[model samples]
Target: MKNFDIVTLTVNPSLDKSTSFRGLVPEQKIQCKNPRFDAGGGGINVSKAIARLGGESLCVFTSGGDTGKQLEALVQKEGIETHAIAVKNATRENLIALDLNTNSQYRFGFSGETLSEPEQQQILEAVSGLKTKYLVASGSLTQGMPPEFYQRIAAIAKASGIKFIADTSGEALQKTLETGVYLLKPNVGELAKLVGVEKIHADEADDAARTLIDKGQAEIVVVSLGPQGAVLVTKDITEFVPAPNVPKKSTVGAGDSMVGGMVWALSEGKPLQEVIRWGVACGSAATMNEGTQLFKADDARRLFEWLGRK
Candidate 1:
């Protein structure tokens, strides 16, 4: 509801190239039967998910080399507004593991080069132009960036009086929370880390979620519980929303799409609980598709209605 729409930032973006193989055999030269590569990284995926839901998100990210050009085209081809910061190094690529018979897959990501001093400044400059009320910064920070890089972003958004929605893990996530993130989407593993709990059982994850809010790290904490669904904890309300049973080709990108849907719904000023409901639906729908692609708006909408009934 401002001069500009949503803006997303990806410090260390990537181009994900995945291959479909018949089977994985260790210690031998194996050729994938089929392979495909697409624009990747959390921010990129978020923007794409937003677009799929008929919303626009300005995607600002760093890229370099031929891969950068390719990524730029890929992002733009989806009709997303893009602001690319050129870097000296090339972009990073990830390998995807797929099992043909079982139709299961695993993905391994490689960390790209760290942004140089000037490159970092360019990002700060971009930060100055955001007019949107919501700014979502997701994914891991590239190495060589100060450990508190995400913290600095959170501070910037907070200082500007903007809402910051963070989705990340490890030190970057922890550091950003200290800067006062508006909301956080953490899976079971991440929530466990935030609360210093070793194993997060389904029954106790809600209590742990409350502890995160109590710690003042995040105003809203949503602990995603895969098939069992997600538990949303706010300062005054905590609800467990069960995801409808959907046929999942793969679980990749389901969480990211959930975050995107939540942000989009909130951007429209929908009610809090409804936003959580939409998020749960989107996450489950993304699982219904194979590969890293997010859920289609139709599927997401259908799932939302289906879940709303109960």
Candidate 2:
């Protein structure tokens, strides 16, 4: 069996389709440009980002029906090794339509298809069988699955000596933290929720993250501040990196890209400061592209260089 240093799990993957049209008129057929398709979902996109950085990771996701087949084909075409767990339900598709006239993007998302008990077991088995150093479980849990789904994966990673990283929200995020993870990437709002606050200011982000670390919820807490860049906080250190200004087109897949960059950097044995820099660079670069196309390697490299000089 081929080995991978990083493994990403997207229990509920999506076949992302995007296009653009002018204006939003009721009861009118809208003429749209040619649609673009990309394999999406948090962990899948993270794997794509890692691959773009000339790194390799196994992307494990659920597959079903035609949409699942399409998703598998799309990721395979990207040259990423995948292990698709067959499910009885068809995979879901997400739509991103850009209004040319208003220059706005409308995202239409569907609830993930439910996973059966046996199928859920398959996902856990798949992860448990993998020999990897880093195990990333991202995205929302499918319908009919408990929020503790990620928490279980966290337990599996812990037992297997894998460094678990989780990027999710709400109850799912809350449950995963109980199991403890190595890294967590949460936006300011999500971090606030974790700490039982209504909201947290940028100044309080370091303390908020430190609280989680102190409680053993996560070893490292990375608070993403959107335009303000990100802050990396551990038990002993806290560092902030300002975001670089760029031509922003879309914010899709930016967080996954950031996680990818950080995980890849960590795998390469980069220090914490450089790791966060690469993450911010890749995430900012992702904003330079539209839909789920993610970030280009050249753009990320340039952004990373620019960040280093700053």
Candidate 3:
């Protein structure tokens, strides 16, 4: 088997199971066929996108009981190498139902069983010993974790000379930013939450983006504005990357795909501008698929050009 130099850590992971039916009726017991299951969570999705792009990465997270084993088998089947810490409770399972005739999808999510302190510590030790060049820590914070975990992880990454990219929401996002993250991917809601601003419209990107940078919280911020595209902010400059007009799929894994593409491009020494292009491309491409199946590099590149990449 080949080796990987990038590692993504997930605090909370799950198995995403989806079923499709011709019609989704209201208040009726409807059965669906063409059901599918996949490994999921923000970091796991990032790893998934990386694998599809012909890159390698190790997905690290907590799993336990039957669900954990199933998740491992599923991920390995998809060719993603993993390093996981087993816990007591069963891993979570998220479900999805798609109505093909209506071209609509519905999803239901569940949180994974929480990890104990020792389990959390063990994962931290594993993270401390990981030899990857890029440590992508993305997703929700486990319940019971200290608020400073992101900050500590950032310090560890700095000490180890690893590029740390964080994608989290709410208070976790704010806490992570306080750690001087190398890069952060925050949607408008997340950005708004961190800034204590409830509304983040297109006109608010400049001020919001600048405020995060000026606070010495994040070095680079990618403010995802959904269909309107995204805003990229550095200490001194901000760039806008518009989304491609593609037939919508399900809007799943778009952010994770963007992070995967960004980290991949940057790892190859691509300029930040080009990296942002690839990130935007991947995110846009992901919106072209349903459930968790994200964009591949080639398809995303084609969409990139159509989106007016210059």
In terms of TM-score, which candidate is strongest? 2
Evaluated against the true structure, the overall lDDT of model 2 is 0.94
Q: Model 2: per-residue lDDT, tens digit, 1-310?
A: 6999999999989999999988899999999889999999999999999999999999999999999999999999999999999999999999998887877889998889889999999999998898999999888888778999999999999999999999989999999999899999999999999999998999999999999999999999999999999999999999899999998878889999999999999999999999999999999999998877999999999999999999
Tens-digit lDDT track of model 1 for 113-206? 9789999988988886677788888777888888688888888888898888888889888888887788899989888888887889888887
Local distance difference test, per candidate? 0.84, 0.94, 0.81
In terms of lDDT, model 3 sits at: 0.81
Model 3 C-alpha lDDT per residue in residues 1-310, reported as the tens digit of each score? 3445788998788888877888777899887786678888888989888887778899998888888898888888878898888888888888887788988888888755667888878878888887778889888766767767777788788888887888877666677777777788888877787888778888688678788788887778888888888878887777888877788877778889999988887777877777777788999888887777778668887866765535
Instruction: Give the number of colliding residue pairs in candidate 3.
Output: 0
Off by over 4 Å in 1: 1-3
Which stretches of model 2 miss by more than 4 angstroms? none
What is the RMSD of candidate 2? Answer: 0.7
Task: Give the clashing pairs for model 1.
Answer: none
lDDT of 1 at 110: 84
Better of 1 and 3 by TM-score: 1
TM-score list, all predictions: 0.95, 0.99, 0.92
